[model samples]
Target: MLETLVKNSRTSVDAGVYEIRGAARGGRSIKWKEGRAALITEVKLASPSAGWIREGADPEEIAASMVRGGADALSVLTQPLLFHGSPEYFARVRRSVDVPMIMKDIIVDEAQVAAAEALGADYMLLIQSVFDGGYAHNMDEFIEMGHNRGVRTLLEVHTAAEFERAQNTEADLIGINNRNLDTLEIDLGTTEEILAGRNTRSRVISESGIKSAADIARLKKAGAAGFLVGSGIMGGRDIEGTVREMISAC
Candidate 1:
């Protein structure tokens, strides 16, 4: 599955020129202000469930639109098998926008971390559910490796147990995913539960289940420092307008 995904991702045009250095390894540190919720706009071509987000959507155009709409950061889906995204897409988005770019993928090894940095990702995501079941990978080693490469890590968790497991690691940014990866079922309340028990030192982000400005406002009030919104904006006929509205609500 991973090989197929990588192959599909390579077909996209090469986007930009940038390099990722690890946070602890002398690279540019992500300047995350206190209580700032970084808006992560996802760049996806398609997904397992939705198939296609926009027909022939220009990555650069979409990225520019996202920045204009008030995104603090960008999360580009590079997994080819599930999201029809590629590293090339991220490179392009990086060139098109000045905000920090996070590579969103189901990372299973250190090599993927190296690849994310090589592709100019300022951040990388590691889903706790993927490692919790002993899926041939260790989160600790991955986080260490990412930090060594100067890439910040976003530990994604779906439940309390996973959240606890992630807290034990050096991960600083925590993503509370409302959608269960196994079932893809969404529940916004998951964000509340996770936030209520989160470690004070860890920065919190609300991922998925966000659609409108009201949703953003509610999550912000709940102490979410940032939001990872994709489907909502992608599904909208007016991406720029929808993004602006979300920012305004927040």
Candidate 2:
């Protein structure tokens, strides 16, 4: 999956699918409202594991619903092939919502960073494995690129080693993703297991497999300061109410 995702990213970069904007408006801070219940709702359509998770849903509507449910920020999947995502979706949702957004792509190149800036995104997702596995530029370099382009970096780590390395960077947020990219599996305890006995000053956002307020509360006890929920809200029968319930839990 990583190989194919990287290939697709490189293809997009080579074809100049992402544009670099000259000037960008400032991005909203992830720490909009304090408390353990900070939420970053996502606008995702599909994924390799969950095919067609929310097909035919408008990005603008999803984003608005997330905000109405008290989302501090938003995340939009922009990978074209495996995730069935597009930069266009990011742009549409970005224009419709006032909250901060993170462009959730595999991000194998600096070009993607520029693209995020062009779309008015406040943050861009940077995979620790993608950089650690020699698939792209150094994580520091990518973080710097994001800074230079007027967007913050959200360093995503799945393992203990990656989490350890993430704290060393200047990224604005460290996402402990429950979904392992290599295995395509989901574990709600990934946040708890990874954060056990670890004191981190960096902002840690638990990603994936978050379903209800209980899930948020458990992750909060695990030392997660924030939550990035996708399918949990997008797949729900009532998006706004689902987000509201989960947001209130933490």
Tens digits of per-residue lDDT, candidate 1, 1-250, equal: 3333333433332222122333222243346656555677887777766788776888889988888888777889876666877667877777667778788877765656877777767889988877676553667888888887778899999998887777788996889998877777889888887778455568778999899988888888878888999988988888888888887765
Model 2, residue 220: C-alpha shift (Å):
0.5
Best by lDDT: 2
Model 2: CA > 4 A from native: 20-24
Clashes of 2: 0
